[model samples]
Target: MAASAPTLLSTTSRLRVSSAAAFRAATAPLLRGEASEWVVRGEATVQVLGRSVRVRLRKRLRMPATRMEEMRATDVSIERGDNATGVLTVASRVSFFSRSSLELVQMGALRVHAYYDAGANDPAVPAAERRARAGRLSSSSVRVGTVLLPNYELRAGYNELEEQIHFDQSLGV
Candidate 1:
């Protein structure tokens, strides 16, 4: 009997933090190539496993910065750590506001894993992945920058040609 092909599954989740001031403070030093330790306090909305939950969270981060990069187009910069890790705790009310509460569940802990590489933009990236991302742009629309204007017309033409190439390849033409 022949073996069946393995199935690939993908799942996505979203998390939003309402008050990020503390989070920003914690991450600021890490972005500056320094060893830093700080705490973050905020309200978070997390959607996972088809369930939405709102809770208050406190996160402690301690990591050393590892990589930094500056973009030439807009003078924007970013930094990250090498295999950064942290921990966080969350608390949420199990029942609606009432005097008679049966139980209080607190101190739900979670582990954080983070990794960054400065060479992401290098040529080692697969061409197919690059093409897939560029294929999302529609050839019909053109938007100009409000500041330090760029050549939108030329960019549109290039994108149209790229889309045509990908379309032709799909049809085996």
Candidate 2:
């Protein structure tokens, strides 16, 4: 007779916890009456309590050297699951032309909610802040996401270098 070694179950549980954090990071809603936006990574998934969701984000972008903004189109899709329930497609949506980039934010799941503006809805927005945010989609980036209430987000920066160049060029000229 032979006996097998004990199962190392912590790894599996750790994966579940990690997934929840990542999902929360992906879905941040930028709203303008009906225009919805947020940033996401190449591939992200989430789990909470016993529930889980799968997410994907894709984007296309373009930025001009003269402008501090860019244009981006994103595709989003999500699937959900739970310890007691089966998996299902729980959410999906499209967002376009965002001023922020997920790449800039640090990783690790977080309980976060965010509001953004691609347009100059507020004239008081300082130029430095706007440039830093890449507002107006000046970076030509894209994002995809899935969320479960509470609020979380990821930034899909479109044109990081171009934005930098725009800033540097401005400083020189």
Candidate 3:
């Protein structure tokens, strides 16, 4: 019998911290290239391949309370130890009332194992093997982002011919 083809998979991860300061502290080492492994939890970790940060905007907002709307963005490439590299565009907003938030604008490509059901019920395959092969799929074929915010605020163009995924969301804070 011919060998089965290798599978490819993709995934997204969300992380929330108590405060933006904490988030910065956690990512400081990685950003400085001091570390490569980011321990998301006890056993779950991701390898930081590279990262770059830029100040998108910095201004003073004189509403609700006098606060600085300093928006900084970072482009990061990470590996889940699965040989898949996930590139992400993340923005961090630090404002008053502790009403801070992180925005993830996902683009680029990642890869993983692809799962097929051609021989799903084969008893020869172990349960763990079957489970891994059940839902493993590549992450390169997905696009998740905000539209209205990027369109009206940033005036970002979305050309289907370019396979562009442009989006944004603002609470007008």
Best by lDDT: 2
Q: What RMSD value applies to candidate 3? A: 23.7
List, residue by residue over 95-137, the lDDT tens digit for candidate 2. Answer: 3333432222333333211224543334577877755655333
Q: Model 3 — which ten-residue stretch has the worst lDDT?
A: 152-161
Task: State the local distance difference test value for candidate 1.
Answer: 0.30
Candidate numbers sorted by TM-score from highest down: 1, 3, 2
Off by over 4 Å in 1: 1-16, 40-59, 64-67, 74-173
150 in model 2: Cα distance from truth in Å?
A: 14
**Local lDDT at 84 for model 3:** 35
lDDT of 3 by residue, 91-112 (tens): 3221111121222233122111
Please report the TM-score between candidate 3 and the true structure: 0.18
Residue 93 C-alpha lDDT in model 1: 15
TM-score of each: 0.22, 0.17, 0.18
RMSD of 1: 23.6
Model 1 agreement with the true structure over 75-133: per-residue lDDT tens digits: 22222222233111112111111121111112122111122222333367576654443
